[model samples]
Target: MAAGEPQAKKLKLEPKQLSENVLFGMGNPLLDICAVVDKDFLDKYGLKPNDQILAEEKHKELFEELVKKFKVEYHAGGSTQNSVKVAQWMIQSPYKAATFFGCIGKDKFGEILKKKAEEAHVDAHYYEQSEEPTGTCAACITSDNRSLVANLAAANCYKKEKHLDLEKNWKLVEKAKVYYIAGFFLTVSPEAILKVATQASANNKIFSLNLSAPFISQFYKEPMMKVMPYVDVLFGNETEAATFAREQGFETEDIKEIAKKTQALPKVNTKRQRIVVFTQGKDDTVMATANEVTTFPVLVSDQSEIVDTNGAGDAFVGGFLSQLVYDRPVTECIRAGHYAASVIIKRSGCTFPEKPDFH
Candidate 1:
């Protein structure tokens, strides 16, 4: 059923059934070095405004230069990592309610990333590789556009046997009932993603993922397809849903049509129906299941309150998952998601308050 917003519930909230490591997520780990610089700085490093690319050999010195010259701030940024952090924040009890697996380096940056994740209460078990330094994405913000150049040094060095495949680590995977993997990991380690996803299907557990970005669908279609059959819940935004529809040859422009078709996509887990959710910023959020599609309107009282939308999407999924692990209704899940996004967009990064007054 469509809703102006998720229906308000009068019933008292149920007691939480959450336990440690109830939610599991894996993705690329990066220390985002964010700063604003002049156009001359972009030209100096052979970069253009509004372009996202891999750091080239010529740009190896760019991260150091940005830190030395610009007033930079570091944020623990990886799509899956951000979502996992938000989920834990929303849980607010049973500390370390979320377990996160990823590869980072045994370096100072890696240490900083560990500290940041711990501060958010996320149980991050990083595979600290010795061969490489660490992964970083330098966000160069100009007045007009933000240019991102990512160097997935140690992040790209993830070995399944060293982490996911290890019996000790697999125990964590077995312990969790729900799993979320960001689409960005499709670039780093599709094989590892498939392993975890396949386990979820075999064990009759919940598996979900985000489209991450339009380029993920455009460039990583093969890896994306390899894991789609195991996806029980899929999330994306308007453009991402549209781009994925095109990549999958759905041949439709209507989001509702795209959503329904995506919802009906092939899945190995026949035990549960797949849910396809697409958010259109302040517009209506679309959620489609095998039976019907529902749209929930988002109300923004004062557009002036939104300071940044950097991790809104991640917060949405995080909020959704926070409720989902406890078996809440989908409508309530969406409601919490909207609430979480609203809170995060008002802040600079993905940070939330001491506790959520979301009841």
Candidate 2:
């Protein structure tokens, strides 16, 4: 199931079974330029291993230096983009099963991202802005760990008026059965989240939100709260879940406790139970539903097979959401999520092989 590994077998769901469900995603859109570097590269760039840093003007020279020294590979990234890609792969129909929305600059990197997404079979609807260059995330990998420097650039131009309602975008929103928005979007456009949440609510669709990172929960608390009631399915890692809990005056760092506390929050959609999925890397993934909190251990491959853990969590959400659209039970959803994560961690960047081994 590793990206470059030999195909084990052909495994896929029937096209007819997949055509009925549609998922929508809106969030930061970036082209990830990745390369393997020596451990000293981190100290040279002042980057902490495994941390996601916002790229500032000062990092421009560092980017230039990396490109000069290493072979680079590009993938369509940004957390929500990664999730949508994995979900589309799981469903086996990118055009029919998923649609992603984001803003990008009318430049070469944007063109690259658009082309790569199409190649991956995702329905990529990008709002092209002439004002800025395409955003990018420089992911430097060393010894299987990744550190990222994200340049928001034109990706941050995701305003409600500029992108959401243009042409057939609103129609796509109306037809979707599930809606997903990355937490990073809150920093750029909270109004976009509200707009999509409102529409998803009116349409009785499933609205899912990924906490993105811990800083998002800390810095964007108000907007996170504003959209929380509308989020029927909430996703976050151990760090993100604990951060949100601490922000709300909870002293506990336990994953199960965090899931319980989040699941108890009031929801706008009363008919649907609030499901909080808390993931602890290499540990059990906790699912908190109306009745109880259940834990499922991550199904990892042999340790030697784990290559780059870059998009593992996002892949998990994609896998989970892929099954969510099919009304699968929570246990099955988590299993699918784990499978997707297992595959992505075996590959570089957020890239996937031509056909995943589903068995």
The CA lDDT of each predicted structure is 0.88, 0.86
| lDDT (C-alpha) at residue 358 in model 1 | 84
Best by lDDT: 1
Once fitted onto the true fold, the runs of candidate 2 whose alpha carbons sit more than 4 angstroms away are 1-16
TM-score of each: 0.90, 0.93
Q: Give the alpha carbon lDDT tens digit for every residue of 195-304 in model 2.
A: 88977877678999988888898889999999999999999988788889999987887888889889989788787888999888889999999899999989967889
Model 1 alpha-carbon drift over 4 Å, by segment: 1-14, 36-53, 57-61, 141-147, 299-301
Decoy 2 TM-score against native: 0.93
Question: By summed lDDT, which 10 consecutive residues of candidate 1 come out lowest?
Answer: 4-13
Which residue pairs show backbone clashes in model 1?
A: none
Least well predicted 10-residue stretch by lDDT in candidate 2: 7-16
Error in Å for residue 117 of model 2 = 1.1
How well does model 1 score by local distance difference test? 0.88
Steric clash pairs (candidate 2)? none
lDDT of 1 by residue, 162-231 (tens): 8998998898988998899988899889999999999999999999989987889999999999899999
